[model samples]
Target: MATIATVTVPRRTPRRVYLERATYLGAAIGLAILPNADLTPATLGAHAAIAGAAGLGLARAWRKAQNLDASSLKTSMRALPFLSAAAVDGAALYLPGAGWDALIAGGWGVSMALLAPLSRSGRPLRQAVEVLEAIEEPEPEGEPEGGPEDDADEFTRTIRAMWERAALPGDTRLYKVIRHSPDGLDFTALVKAPDGKPVPELKKRDVAAAFGVHAEAVTIIESTGGPGWAEIAVTPDAWEAERDKPQTDADWWAHNIGREQGAAPGSTRTGKAERPGVVHHFAKMDDPSEPVRINMRKLCTAFGADTDEMRVFVTDRGNEFLVSVFDQPPLADTVHATRELITPNREGFFRAGTAFDGRPVNGRLYLPGGAAHALLLGASGSGKTQLVIVYMAADSLDGATVWGAAATEDAKLRLAGAHVDRLGFGTLYMVRLLRTAVALMDIRGRMGQKVGHDWIPGAPDNAYGRLSLYLDEFNAATKCPRYGQEITQLGERISVQGRKYGIGIKVSGQDGKVDDGQTSTMRNQLRLNGRQITLNVGDVSAVRRAFNGLISAEDMPEPLPQEYGGSTLTLQQIADGAEDPEDAQGIGGIGWVVRGGKPVLMRTLYVDLGGDDREQVLADLFPDTIGRLTDEETTGLGPLLDDWYAPDPDAEEGAGESSTGRRRRGGGTKKAAARDRVKTFLDMMPGADLDLVLNAVAEDGLTEADITAAYNELTSE
Candidate 1:
């Protein structure tokens, strides 16, 4: 069976309606004023006729706008009173006497002005008003969509409109499913694009773009009812995401730390008094992209929780803030313990520690193409030297070629081992040592270029066997007179080229070392692919310079005690007493290790230097120190007799007599070359243990007599 569709035609507005709409006010006012003003019958009649005709013509013109006649149900109500008043006044204008007619026209004029805004089709005008209203107000337009009607019915109407819009191929219908108001529509939206298709439930970003608010402020939900339908909500998340971002000190306290508003003045609703929260910013804070355990302190920084008494507590789980700033932390301190440092070096790992909650805190500076150099820094008693010793022990024990230079034979200067192939001391000698290193670096660079590859990441047993220059108190070496600048410049060159040549420079120093451009250049080169430690500095400026000015000193931990020097303290140790009056929040650590251009808190290892471990370590690396050489084996150890002197020119080749003196028993008159060897060896070591030197001389293949003679001659000098 075929169905017939009914066609409806739009109704045209009457000409009078358009005429009245345009000329009603003028005509009414003129009629009212005409009665009060002096005028002849011809003028008054002509004016009345003119006004009426003009009103009719205007109404007739507006009548043609039939498409604009769709009035809203509510807007139609507003149009009613005006239309009625117009009718009443029109009747009064005809029925009343002169003065009363004036009153009626004036009344009509007032009604016309009020009705002007509603003159267009009431629904279009209502929608247009709603759009304007939504923009003009802070809240959305969902507020005024309802009137005195059953909410369920209103909701049904709303959902039905949504479905209709969503189902439509080309039309727009913005109706709320659930307006935030208790009696507003339900959570519903029938979103459709201009392509005559329903827009799918969008992601947060899309929804935010659609609604013109922040992505964080809008929550999107894909309703289960149908396709291309979703719900978007407005929330305060955008504002909350920016917590801990204070524009000023007072702003930080007022907005981030505590309540911005207190109970109304003297109101009965008064509660707790206001207080400032102690602020704690996390060092080495994790990135938001990485998963982190939720905590009060992290949350406080995340979505501002404010109070002056905020106490921060750090635990294995993460950092947390408490309501009481003076309370103990939720976690315990990590105590140091000793263990034999027996671990062999592995790929990407050169050092490991048990300082971080008993877990192995591995230190690695091996990049894809180079071995890591290192810089150790700390104040006195802050453990910088100890750390250096630990590192050297590890490297030496692993068979790395260890070379050391020091200004004095201090305790930290004692790193002698089998792997310590050579040592240099004093300003001039250290400068010479650095100059030699610069030459070696040049040689290695040339070799790499010739071989079509820069030598790097080579094993200890590789061609180079991994050489490391451990410079103790690098600042002292850089201050050598007449050679300081040369040393620094050469050091910078080595620093730049060393990493690519199976070589690394481990430099240790206190503050004030980087006082020159050469030092600064060397520091920058070391910063890349170099392991680093920076202990506590007494002043803010020091920290800023040490940390490269990326952090604020106010956010750093307090300075160390006066008695302490060169030894690092853990966060727990510093916190133990820094804020005794307020135990709420604290972080204490002696220094930080630089990683990826940021400082990570130092996790120092507990090295076992006890009898057995120390002996074993020494024995493994220095078996020569385990026993003494007999004196009979060192009797004749001195300048070799054959090399003691040059030939006497005046004497014949075989003659014992010469121009200066008789030829030596083994050869010509004596020379300083043989004695110089012994002198250089003694100077390089300085105050060497007698037995150890005897063993060294024995290892050098010197006979007992020669060894003893060399030692006696060198000591006497």
Candidate 2:
């Protein structure tokens, strides 16, 4: 056996320890001297002030110590010396005698010295050299076997290993395990990045790979707890099950009412037990006053469903948003327009289609006391033309005067059977139609002003009623070199000033790009105060432009599939030389409608524009006859119509004739006619302001540009 030795190590006093001891000694001396001091007013005041300062210092020290630790007894013990000194000083101010001063100073000195042992600031350090010398060296042992891996839980260990394997920036550590089930796990975590480095973006695919699960099994969103935190959930099989499970009316009802309804216990088929529905398992009540809320986003993630598959709709009462889950997107199915659907409701809102959440998508052409313009943007095969047809039919049925302008011959043929008060084709005809619309808008405005109110849609005395201008393939006319500038100016004016007069403009185009023949002024005026709908566009940027950046690329509707729900021709069929199947052209009019300055994914009602029944459908959809403009409403429109039909001066004698094959008597031009018309109007309305004169001549179907030209020509003469 080897002998063991022990050695004593002396304590070394720290500088702070010495200073503390000196402070106590100084207090003791001050107490001793204070009692013998001269008994004068100044001296007494000085003594009391000094005592007060000391007492304040002690109180501050006690407060600081209390804040530093929850152990009140330990704090009091640490502050015992200062407290005692303060008490003695305070007593010296009232008991001014040498004997009392001496007694207090001696007692203070003894108490402080006795408590000195409690101070650990000068604790003794082990004498390393002496200890080493006293102990016998043990035989060298083999390298100690490494202890079992760190005591962290299995989940934590797995997370650490996965983090390292994924090559993710920063160290990911489990913060808390929110839930653990046989199907999945939910948890929050903290990411510790290296100094001066930002938290790395954790891609879902990478994280899933690290966890040996599919990408849809994982969800990561910013934690509301704080920055540098993330909420993660992993549901491996739940998503697959959710996708495969067929949704039923019961499920819809359960989600709508935030409760689970089922057959009651111990009840026969004939008679079932009556009981109140129980709260939904997934519903959370964050506040008693609020409706039961469900985490729709989280549920969607867990089910591996898209936004369209799991949606929320406001209930009929509008008190809560009810969740609706579907095996397939409801909008994927077509919703045909019906008489009731196209007809305006009591509030004058037409049912466009069903929202993703199974709620009716309603749209109105008029605002509270004014009309509203609309802009529809979509690419080819996006069903935009069909949607416009439906809307036009609705407007006609609603008793509005529908003016149609088609830039293409095909568009003209499509609207030929509809109840269009005035249907024009080609850029020339389109420009003429626009000029006429502007004149009518001005006339309506003046009429409203005369009546001392804005135009009302169905007022008994209202003569003009509602007027809607529909422009199909608007880009074609807006891009025409000869008429694009004038068309753009006229469209802008109508978009800005036509609403109050019950005149609205609806323009359909391939995209909303200003550079694509649509001037910035025209796009802004239309989009700023008008309703916008965007179907499957050519690109993400087009969607952004359509909604003025309200919808981002990620939020855009999924591209319209080539073959919607229909099956495509199989490879085997193709190899066998089978004919291609005629599938649905687009995603049943899938698109987005901007509501309340936010883009909401929706689908417009589908109207069958193809097949043999197309003609009958058009006839039934639109009125056979529209209310014609009365004689008074057509005032001054003759010259504009004549100018529109005026033959080209450059054409041969026979070819330079109007559409009705009539020749101008004096070989006069529309500009010359406008000059005369304006001269006559100004003469009749003598001393009238420019506005009054313009209003008086607006019924003549003359645009502001035409009037301005006539004015310039007359003034120059």
Candidate 3:
């Protein structure tokens, strides 16, 4: 029979063999004392042969394992050599005279058996086997098309999601989302009606309550579970009717006294409290559904602003009041809100609402009561005059009257044509203060072309409502002693008391610097109370002080980098700590802010009345320098030219005409060259007109050289 040998495999390397050697060495003495133990030389020789062969075989197997993968079947096959060596060493214990040898061989066999299994050579194979045994399988499917909701429904869901995401404040609910043409999406929200009245929800009565009455009906329109804002529209016809009716100061007092007596039931109306300029009796417009109510004081305050100067007449329409004055003419757009600033360097600087072209215009602060006096300071060509013209024309359109004296003959003429009722205060006609007062009284008659007697002194009855006593070139006004005194007195009155009487003052200069005594008085009045509209202040101390050091050259608007223009910080802002952005809303020449019990900004529409307005006014004031002319076209080599150049008799009659006509260049010249010269002269004007041409020139891609060549060629004889 083939020998079926029990092979003991070594689990480890020589380190294992060394441990076995130590154990055998220790047992040698013990085994020697045994009766069956043979310590013969031949027995030792056999043990040595087995040990050597075992060691050599194990090394060979290890080398073979290196060539084959330690984790492969080749490594396992190669292990037989080491296992056979360990078995031979173990079998040595049964040989004759092998007592000591048996001990050594047995020790080596046990060590190799234990260590062989612990070796790292088989680790990779074990890991691979374990990995192959672990995995998973798949399961069946669920519904594919998902419960059938159309795309519109899905879109609606999205809108709802967006609405939820907005997460507005607690006391506020998003109202109507008006898709306005100019302003894009506008959120119309109602805040508890501005009166101290409680408004729990949007109702017809709540709208009426804002106007101090009740609405006739209530309506509710819900969205189709879609995402859109909410809106409440209400008409308070009855409340408006009561609010619009006119009432005198006495009538107001009587109404309040009746209320006090009625409140106490048995109380007598003996000594009643003083009332405001106007009063009213209001109740919910006889509508059960309208949620209208009132806070009496709020009604009084809102209407009281315009009631002092005229009778407040209520229109039959909803919440509309017609202010009664000289003749009850229609109100202009400015009467409600100021006109836009025409030649602003900064875009969107003063927009209160978006324009028709979708440009933002809202957030502009309107002057409280629309009655503010402005002090402008700028150099001659700094666009000050143009800005002033826009401002005044805008005011007139808004129902405010303007009366001003120009420092330059050109400006005076321009202003007169724009507002024909302007009183000429040029050098030829230096109207005295008393004369000005008379002119103020005669403004209506002059405008109507009806003759009237001059104003009589000490006649309060003839004094007009409120007048803007504009003294252009304020420095010049101060030079005249009498004018300065009158200005001081007038400023004191207007600064302190004008608002109550509806009078305002506007003082300007080509530059706002003044060293004369009038500076102190004027500055004091302005500081106390007045609006300061500065443009291109140019290191002028007085202008700097007026603006409280906020104005600078670099602050000029973007389009016109080199051009100069900007608004000054408002007075209220300066008074109540000018550091905060809110207070300094008007720091840029764009919008207004309301702060410290005043209209922080007056929504001013800069109305560029066109350069023609300026040119016309200048013609009237300085006909001499500006020259008189009639357009003439003669069929000649060139367009028939008539030179009206002559010495301005007003300046110095014998001064003689300039090299050309009084106008910059004499009339006839090459079409292109003459066009260039005229354009150059016009481009040199200040403000809007000049800016327009400059913009055009840039767009046309014309260079200075091109213009110069054109001028030289055209003017050449």
Candidate 4:
């Protein structure tokens, strides 16, 4: 994140444009007057010296002001000789008859605005547009050779090959695949008699030959979808013989689709009503021997649970019929806990548990290479609150101080080992808590500098060992007139730079969109921190906000049904506020985890707040921490801040970066003061721009030119 006003073209403004024009004009004028200094070797040497100094000053200053990246800076440095050469070319072509040479010969033709190259205008900030695409896209498994991205593309190809094989001249083509996965393929295509002809029933040996599986592993669904179409579930013999099979949510849904879809207008079947392709989305078999025309729009609509919210259906023409539904039931088959998750390691890594595909997930979010924070977007009853509780419990048990901020005044949690001194809820206390945290962060930074530490959380000297802030119902709080500004500022600071100070944040909200008037930088930084946990938001908008437009309609998480007349409400209804939150209790604990730089569907442990197993469930989750936060002494913090607040009415609201956001400079001593300055500026402008930062820098008595010089010297290399 370097300032690279002059080196690249990512960020641009009127000032940068003016500076560029001035630069060309300045060079043009110098070229227009050069050779008349006797046209001698002495003059040539002086000219080269002047050009070198000018190039270094201008390049370094612009780089510092605009925060150019290293690559761009290197490019500009390589062009330095060209700049001098261009001036020489201009001097070589200048007409001495024009009298511009006569003035230079008399040593009186020096231009006054030539000094303009030294002004802050000459060093105008460069627009740092990130042209570099992300080099890494995280995916689960099977990629030591080519990687998961290649695997995904290959998976799409597999679908094409499967359909072609199924459409073979003699093989059975009576199944439409609804779900595809490495484990099994869920097919919806029926096997009824064709017109007046009798349908050939699948034989065990024939099935084995067609599917490339053993005769013993071939299984058929004789219960649902009338006579023509039957659900076929194929698994390895090893997997089937196990006592506890790897039954997933997709498996659960597939096993129950018969009951949900009502046996597809039944025939004389006598088995339990189970749909043929409930787990169609998880299917991954290839037996096609003929071509299949895949109609994605129609198939997706038919396959999806909610029609109104289901954007697309199944379509296939070789490689175009798949939907990446990492959020739905079959994908995020089940949920586990911190015990099954959060594997504490000496390397300071934690295995966060499985993604939708049943692959292990580990996220070191607070660590240097991690995203620094986790952003959650879930509608009410979408498991946002519960997940927050789990995260807090995990960190608390791992010896991190957890600071919580909620919109309610009387928030109570059954956290087992939480320290009460860190809990702050409601608007006022939340503000005080954040401000105090900011102050603490500032002080700790100075302490870390003294101890020669960069990011050693939980170190003995670091009193606030790995502080994790969990802000529930973040959007609702952001709408507050007075506190909205502060919350936004605190959050932005912690997210953008907190990785180095043992601080991290997890912000959850009903919708993922930023407030209407939020600045671009804040929004970008918010999205930039990609460790997102998106639950069943039940809306296309929330999906886009969380996944960044990389998902499909059928891929959307199926809305959790309402208690009574559950099918009557749609996810859009819940997202648009038409459906009651109480009614839309969210479909289980299914969600997506976009940590490790990739989106993977995941589910948290099953939790029903009103169920009788609540206590036992909590106990199971945190045997050591459950009910451990009973008294002040055990909790470590003094007491719950049920009543604590202070208001600064005169404080300007909506300022993004405050003086409290410490900006690193030349020395360790200035760290606290820099943070205070950042806090002060943010108090004035919620998300301060370059103008605001420069203004604050000036106000602090650090003159712009001197600041520029220092910054250039520090960052130029």
Candidate 5:
């Protein structure tokens, strides 16, 4: 009412808009009149020509203006309604009745009226043209003043820089910031590749580096929404918060007792009459005058109601108490039952000890129908050597040949009385033992081929019985300057291929990394196919390296303290030389074993045969009968052993050899000489088999062992 004068809003009309409207109108009129006026071919022909002309004009207008793509599926589908109407008119030409013709005429008129651009205000044509014209125009360059980049925080910029530095495929853009706090940042992102390429993986380390944080601080996981999408989180302060929030006594008791919340200390004491043997005593933290005693039965029910026995003791630090629940008193916990668990079970798995929950800790010498290499990793005083002896004893009891090697003099002395078929005591001996194992593996492989099957336990025809090679201080042996390469090569061969031939390898190392030399390949193979036992270590990294990330640092076993202080003997009694507690000496059998592809906490069996004498204890646990190899099985191994035992000819004439004997430096030269001799013999006896060559070389003072070694060396070359 305020504006008396009319204000006109200008509408921009497309080029040839009038011509397009006229063409459609003319075509509609022709089709409507043709159905009513004529049954002649000329009238129908005229109608068809008009419709064709209209379609041609509309297509040209669209192309010239660049408003729409003529070949697009959208454009073709839009023409369906008009085409359907035309088909009905064409059918009317062949119909005999006038009723059908009239009906077709009406349908054609209605379709054309709706489709035709009758005016600038016609909705169908006007809306379509506007949309197409908008699409044809190019979008304005550059983002608006308050665009995404301008609004993004420092964390977002850092993420963008990280993607660039990592050289990840695609253009990653932040979709939304879910959170941004001093503690962390959480966000979702979209990755778009050029020309529809796939998005590349986002590694955690790359993201961490971008934010100047640790790898564990950042987490990058692909979104489940679809491809080319990911969810990222960066938390620098989360670790500190978790570390500071220590678990309280109430929290620990609640978790252990399988309760949502801990019961009030004094409240539970009143219900002792209803729950007999449940409540013992309780005291408030603020009241020091009150007596303090914990209910044993209530704690026992946390493990299970049927629990009959429990052992409670304080840690060496006096900071916490540990309660071990057991259904039956663990036999391995006492020295009196030492022999009960050392024996191998029916399936050939040795009962090493019991877990904290009193489950049997069983490990096998060989995997029966699979690979049976074992890795024992722990720090010194972690009972690793004791566990190794248990495994050796189990194998010996099963009639398996046990070959032992120690990297140090002390280790050698400890294993001296074990049921070893062959024992090597020092670095040189360890290397020689490895080489012999490799040669034996090759021989057994060949023997298996001739027998037409893999080695089976207790087979009558299988002369090469089960052989278990135990390596103590393996990390030290691998670091030897003269024989490290050869040792690594031999270890790898046995780890990869020895299992099928009834050959098993067990390695014990103080350092779980084994990074001192070329033992990485061999270590990887063992981790993949062997059972791994990691005892209390000095640090978390040792366990991580041993299992190759199969176990995380959070799950690593707690390191054993240097001193075991929970002794029953009083200070005056200790001065009297009564002796320290037995648990103190074997304080740390506690460790982890990989069971069912997961780490399980366990304590190895206590071997207390000789009281405090370590050597006597080992010797007592070992079997009385030692398994030995037959002459036939030790054919090529004899010469290798002879060379190992032989003194170094290069040593000074008056100097005495060490207890472990001098290493043979000229063994390589002798091996080269043997290879040459075998080559010369083979050149004369071409196409000859191993047996033929052995017989032919007999006159030359060459034993079958020499021939076999020489032939193997030459063939390998």
Candidate 6:
């Protein structure tokens, strides 16, 4: 093969380049000719032209490099020390000054070198222009209509409506939502079927798949405009197919009960081990025809008690029959459990996840030993105070003894114990001991002491193990110079060791660094060992320290104090001698337990102490008075109790006063007992005179003024 010579083509220069060379050369030549002429014009012109040409080339090169997005351009410009030297050299050639003329020329040269890379690219300017254009142009139309929140809201509404329509009474968990863009939203809900498979007809999953979400997310939920819809989880094909086509009556029937009809009727069937109607018989046990009868007392005694096909009503008729006597009816049966049995409104505390009749469940029933101690941290109006009262009242009616205290006077007096004796060692005995120094001292001394042991200094005898001290505005308590130590001790004892015995404490407060003197102690006793609940007090550092990775610094900004009332974080529980943390699925890991008269997804907002005879108690009891007596007090209650109703003596028998004549009775024992019973029943009604007492019992305090304002605000709207 013949050898081929490869020519390396030189880079091009513009035709106008010669003009630049000529301009610099002419100037140098003219300068040399006008001067004393120690140098020739040719040499001067040549040198000047060389420098000017080089500078022009450098600038061009720099611009080009920058245009191509050369990363090193800026660095190269910054690193050019030689530019300064070149500038000095160029200056010296025109005006000679010792060795400085050479320095001037060198400086001029260096400046040219630095400018070289600038010519490589104009990328920054182009990028800035592109950004401006993008901002000026309108966004492309026909994107997704709603955001994640809108979708979530819609999804929630859908599921909520479906549940309501199905007439399934229980808690409905919004577990998760899986989305496929341009299709629709899909979500999952969990229901409890204690006895068998939950009744499927009670819950329907309707959705739209065109938008990449389930039609149920849109059709069934409450839409507050836009894409606020909740999507329930269901088969995508069914959802998509139904998007354009309307379902006929036959289709609707098939869609609603097809699965049920296909299922085998007995427990012996493989795919139909659980009958839909049998799953939630307990939640509606009151229906007269219930195939089963479960003792409420027995059911409340343990966490998990069998109440399955063990014989419950299979029909809605007002009759009773054993489960063994029951048989599967026709496939199209539409039986509903009656309201008489297992009504959600009955007295009891139910965990969040439990369910009844294919519905999520909530209600509180006292199991004697199910009491829990909690600490709440948040700023004022965070709803922490209300949460504490709600827990206490609900638990108290369930046979729990509640004792509550708060810094404010109104709070203490309102929630004070109705009958300290009724509060005994196991009843809810809310004590308003936040007033005097002695009371503070008494509580402090009793902080770490167990309830069954000897009374601590300042504490009353028989109050041990019988009290659940609810301290509201804990920061105020801890801030008091005289009472702060007691407060600290209280935190230590309750948070670190209070769970073993029946006694418990729920403390609420604002946030700030704990006093250095108490920080370590609080850490070991309160924060480290206690289950911490933070309500929207978004102090990142404080939260990080209090909860570590359970919550991150980023989440703090989202739960600021201004966002209080709705959000709360519960840290792990640390019992004495325990090694591991609780594993609740949510952030705080403490799944919310609702305690109320009905199905509530909220964290047991407030307890209904069933509005018991608050009016009678309010009219009857006063400080230093015989206090409202129960019906049982009338019998064998002698002269010492007489003054209780002295002014109305013979009003009724057995209406007696206390040892001090300062205390008085209402009437004779017989009449008094009757009145007491009536008062108790009345108290169970709404808006009783003992409203303050009820509020305090239910929420540890009765700030009536605040309550009045809240009531007016709610009613006015």
Top lDDT hit: 2
lDDT of candidate 4 over 171-249, digit per residue (tens): 3343333333444442223343333333456665554454455454556666243343334554443434432577655
| Candidate 5 local lDDT, 1-717, one digit each (tens) | 010112232333444455555555565555555666745788767667646755765575555445555334344444543555466557766787777766666666565555443333222444575466336432123211221233355555555555555565466554454444543444434443332344567777766665566565566766653454456776656634543578764434434432322222321211111122222222132234323233545654554432222232111112122344333333235322255566776666778767644578778765557447888877877777777777877777777888888787654335444457777667777766766666566566667787787776556787468888888887777666555544666677778778887888888888777664536767776777667788877665565666666654434443444433234566699899897656533445767776645466667876553446866666566667888776765664445545454553233433322343333433534454345445644543344457544533332233567778988776666
Error of 6 at 3 (Å): 41
Q: What is the lDDT of residue 553 in candidate 2?
A: 46
Tell me how far the alpha carbon of residue 43 in candidate 2 is from the true structure, in angstroms, after superposition: 55
**Candidate 2 structure quality by residue, lDDT tens digits, 1-717:** 111122232333444455556666776887788767777897687566766766765676667675666454454555566566667877866785688887888788766865663253222233363256224321112211111122344555455556566676566544344335423443334443433343567777877776666665667876543344455665555655654588654443333333322211111111112223211122223233543333344445434443333232221112223333454445666788876688775455787767765577776677776666778878877888877877787777787887777777664245543466777667777776777766666566667676677777556776467878888788778777555655776676777778777888888988777764666666665666566777878665565666655544434443444434334566799999998676433454777776654456678887787767877767777776674665655663444444444443324333233543233433655655455546654543333345644643452245778777777666567
TM-score of every candidate relative to the true structure: 0.44, 0.52, 0.27, 0.42, 0.46, 0.27
Model 4 lDDT, full chain set: 0.47
lDDT tens digits by residue: candidate 1, 381-453 = 5556556656665555545566677665655345343335566566555655664454445445545565566
Query: Which wins on TM-score, candidate 1 or candidate 4?
Result: 1
In terms of TM-score, the best-performing candidate is: 2
Lowest lDDT 10-residue stretch of candidate 1: 262-271
> After superposing candidate 5, which stretches have Cα over 4 Å from the reference?
1-332, 335-339, 411-415, 458-461, 516-518, 563-586, 609-620, 648-717
Off by over 4 Å in 4: 1-297, 300-340, 343-356, 360-364, 409-421, 457-464, 516-523, 526-530, 549-586, 595-600, 611-717
Q: Against the unseen true structure, what C-alpha lDDT does each candidate score?
A: 0.47, 0.59, 0.37, 0.47, 0.57, 0.35
Q: Candidate 4: deviation at residue 624, Å?
A: 5.0
TM-score of 6: 0.27
Q: What is the lDDT of residue 587 in candidate 2?
A: 58
Off by over 4 Å in 3: 1-371, 411-415, 418-420, 427-435, 438-464, 481-494, 517-521, 540-717
